[model samples]
Target chain A: MKLMDKLQILADSAKYDVSCSSSGSSRSNRPGGVGNASLPGICHSWADDGRCISLLKVLFTNVCIYDCKYCVNRSSNDVRRASFTPDELCELTIQFYRRNYIEGLFLSSAVIRSPDYTMELMIKALRKLRHEYRFNGYIHIKSIPGADMRLVHEAGSLADRMSINIELPSVSGLKLLAPQKDPASILEPMGYVRERIMESRELVLYKKPQPFVPAGQSTQLIVGATRDSDLKILTLTEHLYRRYQLKRVYYSAYVPVNDDRNLPSVNTSPPLLREHRIYQADWLLRFYGFKAGELLDEGHPNLDTHLDPKCDWALRHLDQFPVEINKAPLEMLLRVPGIGYRMAAKIIRARRVGPLGFEDLKRMRVVLKRARYFITCNGRYYGGIDLDSGLLYQLLSDKTDSKVMAGQISMFG
Target chain B: MVYVTDGSFEGILTAVFEAFRNREDPEEITLGGDFQLSMTAGIREISTDTEKSDRVWRGVESKISKESLENLYMAYLSEHPRVGLYIYRYIKLGLNIGRKVEGYLQHPDVHAIYDLSRRVGSEAHLFLGILRFKKLRNGVFYACYEPDNNITQLITDHFASRLSDQAWIIHDRKRDILALFNGEEVIFTSGFPGIDHEDCEGEYEELWKRYFSAIAIESRKNPRLQRSFMPRRYWRHLPEKQL
Candidate 1:
């Protein structure tokens, strides 16, 4: 088949994975190398779906042996199958890099013939791109679930980042939809990658550091795939972060592509708002001092779809409000509804100079509309209304009209 | 009094020097050729004096932090109409308050300088991703861009470090200048007009266009969000936006 024909089929099949970040690795260009990786990733283009297309995300092939019910390229599905030769894939990447089309290659594949076979093909393409073509750009490849440990290790050394998708949030869900896959198959490789990364750090202290996934590893969890509650997902995510030390946990809203008895109805719209709320809560977990248990519990098994997680948390714990912004610590400042990391840092810096008032916060570009209810600048409250939860919820939620809410939700859907 | 400069960064600094040396508050500062005839205020044309500009820059460097120095240069690159006077006020305030002046966000001049500098900096950062190169017949990649701010010089190091093994030219069509990186060193030159270059014939461009279209999920097509990130103003040079 033609290269364009294969790219359309393979890239379309790979689009649902939705982990396209190319940041966190600063691989410099060698003396005769063609590219370098930026510390903060660059988005080459914004797709029509409003997602950043940072990497040339494509599958090595769309032919699978295992019939995962949720996947587009599952074995039973009668989709067109195609695969790229190692040389063709490397040439495509170099040509696109020369034209400034992408940061690097994000290569994934279906279980073509066997896990080991698929991984070997991916490693061959990466080796040609890195060694033969002398390309030093960011390359993110997938670690096949049941690939050989040696093949996984070799692929890790060549790629900047690697990901092993958990596919579903729970073990029972995996059993119901993808019986051929098991949790151990996924976690074993993740454990190995983490160990090697730590060993590489230690080796760096003694010798020239060899890059083994310098951008770190990340995984994706399919939201709304099964009847998994937000609590269950968060619990699993927390475990992954603490145990595996993963860089990111991307949550892709389950878009119903296959008509399976186990999956959601084909007519159901993806849970984009839920995915967004999960991202917000994820930010709180990673940046803010909030733990997963603090954000959601047995009483509230799901995030408030209308209100953001921060605002919801603030409203629930009103006793924490009315904190003096001038004297509050950085952690306290970050808990405010509208205050972000950058704004909190600014407040900390500016307050060191002198006592700041509400005007100072406004001039510093702080979003006072939501923060005023929770903060007191210089012992004075600027939130004119009384501290009523119902009133505040009405005010905050009413500001976003239905049309604007739809626009915002669909932007990251 | 109004002060007119020669439209270079040094000329603006020189105008500030002249304003401070004369101890006169200029009502306005503009580029040399942009002086409007005023009915009452006197106009002074300041030549580009490297010695005076360097002294003023040294004073700024010693008084403020290195970050503040970058802010001043970025604000000058913004090319806003009243940015000269705003930067002058910012420098005067910074000199008085020492390095703590950056935290004085309440000051109008400080706030204006910060906003202008951020605008230029963000635009330059955006082009680091948005700029696209097309292979020419001579094996030198060429790209053309028309950014709102004068950021051609600011983004050279980024591409130079990334595409270090290839020869490339980034032509700023609006400013009529080109940044040419020939594998090792980068140099600025006058922009050249259309050349007799043939487009490379390959399936890679076609493959890229296909991948670009295929990756977007059809269920969530949001052109407004796409425009917010990659605005319509920059669509002219993007290969995916082309046929």
Candidate 2:
């Protein structure tokens, strides 16, 4: 087949994997190298789904041997298959980099003939791109489950970041949808990569450090794939972060691409709002010092779709409200509905000059409408109404309703 | 009195220096080319004096933090109306209150300077991501951009550091300036007339367009969100946006 035809098929097949970030690694250009990786990632373009397209995300091939019921490129499905030679892949990366089309390359693949064989082809392409072409740009590649441990290590050394997708949240879900992939097959490679990263850190203390996934590893969880609750997903995500030292855990709302008896109906919309709630909860866990159990417990297994996770938490714990903004610590400031990390830091810095008032907060770009209810500046409260839980919830919901209506009009018009 | 400068960063600094030396708070400060005849005020044309500008810059560097110094430079690059007077007022405040003036977000002059500087900084950062290049027949990678701020000098260090092995030119068509890097060092020149070089018709460009179109999911098409991140103004230079 022609190259353009093959590219269309492969790229179409690869778009479902939504982990397109090329960040967190600062690999400098060598004396004769052609590129360097920026510390904060650059988004070269945004796809129609509002996701950043930083790297050239493509699959090495779209031919699979496993019959994963949820995947678009499952073995039983009848889709056009195409594969790129290692040379062709490397040449494409260099040419695109030269033309400033991408930050680097994000190479993934289906289980072509076998896990080991597919991984081997991916490593070959990466080796050529890194060593032969003298390209030092950011490269992120997927590690095939059940691949050899040695091959996984070699690939880790060459790429800036590596990821192993835990497609399902639980073991039973994996068995029902993708019986060929066991929990051990995925966790084993993750464990190996973690160990190598630790070893590389130790080496850096005394000797010249060898790079072993300097950007760290990340994984993806398919939400709405099974009947897994948000509690279950958060628990597993917490475990992965603690166990694997992962950089990021991406949540992809399940887009129904295949007609499977075990999956959601083909007409069902992806649980986008639920996915968004999960991401907000994830941010709180990572940055705001909230534990998974603290955010959700056995009683509350799902996030409130109408309100954000932070606001929901704040509404439930009103005793923490009316905190004096002039004297509140950083942690207390972060718990406010409209106060973000950046704004909290600014407040800390600004308070050094004198006591801050509501007017100062507005000038500092704080969302006074939402923050007014929770904070008091200099022993004075500017929130107009009484503090009743139901009334506050009603007020906030009314604001959200108007905002969503405005968004719909702007989007459609 | 109103002061008129030559529309350069140094010229603005020199005007500030003269304002402090004469101990006169000017009613307005504008570019010499853009100076309008105000029937109510006297106008003073300040020559571009490198010595006076350098002394004022040195005073600012010693009195304030390096971050504030860069913010002043970025605000000057914004070329916003009355930005010269705003910077002058900010510097005067910084000198009086020391570096703590930067965090005084409630002060109007300090706030205006920060706001203008933030716009220029954001624009330069956006161009870092959206600037696209095309390979010419002579193996020189070329790109054309029309940024809102005078950020050509600010963005060249990034490209020079990354693409050190290749020769490239970034033409700021809006400002009639070119930042050319020839595998070793970068030089800025405004003398070269714009060239219409024929781009190499490589097969990878075709593959790139195909990949870009194929990667977007049809079910969740939100062109508005895409435009919010990658604005419509940058689409002219993007290869994937064409055709």
Candidate 3:
């Protein structure tokens, strides 16, 4: 097949894997290398789907051996399949990297023939890019679920990041949708990669320290493909973070492409709002220091689609409301609905100079529309309504949610 | 009364020194080219001196903090009309109370410098990814961009090291500035004619444009959201956006 046709087929198949981050690694260019990895990462463009196009996200090939019902590339599906030669993949990455169209390459592939064989081809492509072309830029590769440990380790040393997607939330869901894929096959590599990452960190002072997965591991969970509670998904995400020390856990709303009795109908829209809510809760877990228990309980088994998770949590714990902005600790400020991490830090920094008034908060650009309900600037409540009134709930629930789409991050603070 | 400096960063620093030496608070401080002849009352032209500017720069470094000095410099790069006056007032408060002035969000002058510095800093950072290079027929990679602030110098530092092995030129069309990197050193030129490239829209660009469109999930198409992250202003130079 032509290179353009191969790229189109492979990229279309790869579009569902929504892990496009290029951060947590800072590999500098060698004396004659062509590129470098940035610490915070850079987004070359945003796709029409509103996702950041950081790396040249494409699959090495789209032919699979397993029939995962929710996946577009499941072997049973009647879709076009194409594979790139090692030279073809390397040339595409370097040329795009030279033009600053991408920070690096995100190379994933289906289980072609076998897991180990697919991984071998991927490593060959990666080696050519790194050794022959001297490409020091970021390369994030996916470990085919059941790939051998030694092969994964070999690939880890060459690539900046490695990930294994946990597509289903529950074991039963995995069995119903993808019976051939075992849960052990998914978690085993995650455990091994975590160990290798720990080893690399311990050997930071080695005279010739070889880094392994310098950007660390991340995974994607397919939301709404099966009957999984937000609480269940979030608990698993928190477990992944605490156990594996994963850099990020992306949630891709299931876009039904294949017809299956167990899968949601293809006519149904992807649950994009639920995915956005999960991401909001994900941020709360990672940065806001909130626990799964704090955000949800048996009574509220799902995130409220009307209000964000942070706002929902604040409304439930009204005893913590009206905390004095001048006296509240950093943790308390973070719990406020409209204040993000940067804004919370800014408030703490600005308040240290003198008592901050509402005017100062406005100047500091804190979104008082929601934060006002929870915080008191100078022993005065500007949120207007009484704290105990249920009216705050009606007022705080987002109405102009027309802009609230999945992967559309406003980042207002 | 106003002070006119020689329209350089060091010249602005020297004006700060003169404010301290003469013990007179000027109404405004103007860079040389920005000065108007109509306002001639009590206007003093402050000459640039490395010795005096260095003293002021070092004082800001030792007394306030290195970051504040960096912030002041980035704020100066905004080239705002009254940016010199804002920097003067910001330094006055910063020297009085040291680095704590960074957190003085209520102060108008401090907020001005903080906001401008962050704008310039973030734009320079944004240009790092927004820049697009097309391979010219002559074999040199060429890209063009138009930024609001004076950030060509800031972004070129990043490309110089990242693409050091290849020859490239980044043209800032709005300011008519060029960052020419010839496999070794990057030279900044103001106006030295132009090289021609019709942007042949080569095969690689076609592949990139195809990959760009294919990677987007069709079910979740939201053009408004795409514009928010990659704004309309930058779409002019983006290769895939052209499609």
Best by lDDT: 3
Candidate 1 vs candidate 2, lDDT winner? 1
Give per-residue CA lDDT, model 3, range B98-132, as digits (tens). Answer: 99999998788988898999999888877898899
- Model 2 / residue A163 / CA error / Å: 0.3
What TM-score would you give candidate 1 relative to the actual structure? 0.96
Per-model DockQ against the true two-chain complex: 0.66, 0.61, 0.78
Residue B82's C-alpha lDDT in candidate 1? 85
DockQ-derived CAPRI band for the predicted complex in model 1: medium
Residue-wise C-alpha lDDT for candidate 3, range A150-263, written one tens digit per residue = 999999999999999998999999999999998999999999999998988889876567899999999999999999999999999999999999988889899989888888
Candidate 2 per-residue C-alpha lDDT over B1-243 given as tens digits, one digit per residue, 9 for 90 to 100 = 899999888998999999999999988888656767789999899999999999989989899777888998999888887899998898888989999988887677887888889899889877887888877788888888999899999899999988898899999998899999998899888866655644555566777888789988887666776787778888887878888
Q: Residue B121 in candidate 2 has what lDDT?
A: 88
Ranking by DockQ: 3, 1, 2
Model 2: residue B21 alpha-carbon error in angstroms: 1.2
TM-score of 3: 0.96
Docking quality level of the chain pair in candidate 3: medium
What are the TM-scores, per candidate, against the unseen true structure?
0.96, 0.96, 0.96
Model 1: per-residue lDDT, tens digit, B197-230?
3564445556777889999988877787788788
